[model samples]
Target: MAPPLTPADLTPALLRGALEAERTERGGLLPHRLPAWARAQNTDGQLTMAESQPSGVRLAFRTRATVVELDTLPTKRAYVGVPPRPDGVYDLVVDGRLLAQGSVPGGHVVTVDMTKGTFAHTPGAPGTLRFDGLDGTVKDVEIWLPHNETTELVGLRADAPVEPLPDGGRPVWLHHGSSISHGSDAASPTAIWPALAASAAGVELLNLGFGGGALLDPFTARTLRDTPADLVSVKIGINLVNLDLMRLRAFGPAVHGFLDTIREGHPETPLLVVSPILCPIHERTPGPGAPDFSSLADGQLKFAALGDPAERAYGKLTLEVIREELARVVAQRAAGDPRLHLLDGRELYGAADYAELPLPDELHPDAAAHRRIGERFAERVFGPGGAFADR
Candidate 1:
C-alpha cells in the first residue's frame, strides 16, 4: 500500500523537491516540452514556434473581493515558459499582491510566491489554490504574463476540504470570436468580454477566442463540432478584414461552412451567429499589405498597416455587411432549423458604446467596453427566460 502524505510532504517545499528530482532525471512539466506542432493544433497555432511555444493551459480563480477567513492554503506552484517579449519583465501576483516581478529566462519555469497554509490536491492536478487562517471568503485571484507569450499552471494545493463550484447546471455556452472575445488589452482575465458575458449570464463558457487568430479554419470548426455544449455562438467577419485572410466571395461561404460544421455536433442547440460591431477605421479600409514586422522590429513603425485600398472597400468587413450576411444566413438556416438563433454583435458592443469607451486600437475593446458588452449580452441573449436562462 502507498504511504500517506504527511504535512511536510505537501508544502511548497515539496514543489522544490519535485523540481529537483525532475531535473536529475531530465524531466520537467509535461506541457513545457510539448512540441510546437502539437500546441499549434489550438486556435493560436500560427504563433507557435519551437523556441516560443505555450507551456499549457492554466486555470485561475478570482473573487469580487478578498475574504478574511483562512481555512485553506495554496499548495501548488504553477509556472509557464514564454518567449521574450518587447517588454522585458513579467508580472506575477497572488490575491492582487505583486509576488514576483522579473525578466523571464529563456524556456524556464517562473514560480509565484504563495501564502503559507495547508492544502489538499483534488481530482484535478495541482487542484484549486485555497487559503487557510482567514475569516472571510476570497473572491478574485489573478496572474498576468507578458503579451505574445505562453504560460501554464503546473501545481495546486489547498489545506482544508475544498469543493470547486459545481459546473452551473445550465448547458455550457461555447463562443468563438476575434481579439475582442480573447480578452485583448483587458485589465484582467475576468475583465474579458466573454468572461464577463458568461459570468453575467451565469453560464459555463468555453471561449475559443484567439487574437488575430480567428481566421475561419477547418480545424477550428472541427474543434467546435467535437466539443459538447448546450448553446453556441460564433462572432465572425472582423478577423477576416483585419487579417486580410479572405475576400467577399470566400467570406460568405466560409461563414456558412463554419456554421455547418458546428451543426454536426449541436444540431438542435440554440446557435447564435454574430457579426462584428462598428469600427470606422476598418469599415471602409482595405488591406493587402503584409504585416510590417520589419519596421516594427526596428521600432520604425508602431503598428501594421492595411495596404490594399481596393480590397479594403470590396473585401473589407463592415458591420453593415456582416449584419446583412448574418441575417441572410440565419434566415436560410431558420427555414430548416428552428433551434438556431441569430444576434447582431452590435447589440453586445456597438459604435455608441465606442463613443463612451473607445477601443484602444481600431480592433479590440477596452475594459469598460468588456463590462458593457457583458451587461448587454446578459440582457439580450441570456436575459430572463432567454435561450441561456432557466426555463
Candidate 2:
C-alpha cells in the first residue's frame, strides 16, 4: 500500500458540482456552492450557511485502489433544546452505483437557539473516513459529501494514484429550490430528489438548492445565468411565503426579473419554473412560518404557519397565490420564450401522496416523499415527450 497523500494532493480538478473550493486557514478545502463573486454579495447568514453545505458536491476520480481514506472536518448544526441531528453521511459510489455509506466520527458542532436567534460554536477535530475492499479493476469513484453539513476536505489517501474522471458528455441539469431540493430530510446526499431525478434521466447534476435561501435573489439568478447547463429549473414560492419576504406586488416583478437574468445566458435552454409543493400549512394561509415550539418540547422539531389566511386579501403571498402568479408569469412569457415551461410542484406531491407519505415536519418531505418526488419529476420533465426531452 502507498503512503497516504497530503492535503495538496486533492486538487480542484477532482471535485464535481461545487462552484468553488476555497482554501481554509487550516489548510483544508471548503467547498462553496456559489462562486466567490456571488458569495461576496451574500448578507443573510442563512443563505451563506446553506450554500456552504455542499448539497450535491462530490469528489470524482478514477482509480484501481482497493482501499481509500479521507479526512474531513464537518460542522453539524444542533438546536439548543432539540435532539441533536445525526452525523452527516458520506456516500461512496463506484462506477455510478452506490456502494457504501458512512459518517465521520468527530466534528465541530454549532448549537442554535431558534427562540433567541443565537448560536454557539464548539470546535472539534477532524476525523478520517475509510472504505476498503473495492473491485481491483480501474473504475470511476465518487465520494458524495454530506448534504446537510458544512464539510472541509482535509486529505485523501488511496493505494493507487487518482485522476479526475473525464466528462462523460452528459447533459447538465441545473436545479435550484429550497430545503426539499437541498436534501433536508433525505437519507443521503445521492438520495436527494434532484440527484435521484438526474440519475434516473442520465443527466449530470449541478444543484443550487439552498435551504431557506431560494427567495429569488438576484445573485442566485446571476449564478444560474453564468453557469453552463443543458437544462435549468427553479423551484420558487415556498421560501418567499415562509419568510414573508415580499407581497404580491413585488413577487411578480421578482419572478420576471429572475427569469430574465437566466435567459440572458440560456435563452434557448429548456427552463422549467416550478411552483411550491402542497404545503398544507401555507397552502391557503400567508406565512412567515414559525416553528412549532411545542414539538421541540416533545423532542421533535416541527413548523407551523403563523399568518392568517385572510391576509391574502391584502396581497400577502400564500402557496395558492404564488402558484397562480407563477403559472400566469410562465404563460405570459411562453409566447416569446417557447423553451420556457412551468410545472406545478403539487403534481410531484399532492393531496393524495401527502395522505400516504406526509411531511414529517409539516414543511419538508421525508425520504420516501423525496424518492416519490424524484421519480415523478423524472417522468414529467425528463421522460419522453417531457419538457426537457430530446428534440
| Per-candidate TM-score against the hidden true structure | 0.65, 0.98
Locate the minimum summed-lDDT window of 10 residues in model 2.
1-10
Instruction: Please list all clashing residue pairs in model 2, or write none if there are none.
Output: none
Question: Candidate 2, overall lDDT?
Answer: 0.93
Model 2 residue 58 lDDT? Answer: 96
Angstrom error of the Cα, residue 208, model 2: value is 0.2
Question: CA lDDT, every prediction?
Answer: 0.52, 0.93
Q: Best candidate, TM-score-wise?
A: 2
Q: Candidate 2 at 335: error in angstroms?
A: 0.7
Q: Give the TM-score of candidate 2.
A: 0.98
Give lDDT tens digits, candidate 1, residues 78-177. Answer: 3122122232223334543544433333333224212232223332211223233332364333333232244322333333222222333655777777
Could you give candidate 2's per-residue lDDT for residues 300-358 as a string of tens digits?
Answer: 88999999998999999999999999999999999999999999999999999999999
> What is the alpha-carbon RMSD of candidate 2 to the true structure?
1.3
Once fitted onto the true fold, the runs of candidate 1 whose alpha carbons sit more than 4 angstroms away are 1-149, 161-168, 288-309, 312-319, 385-391
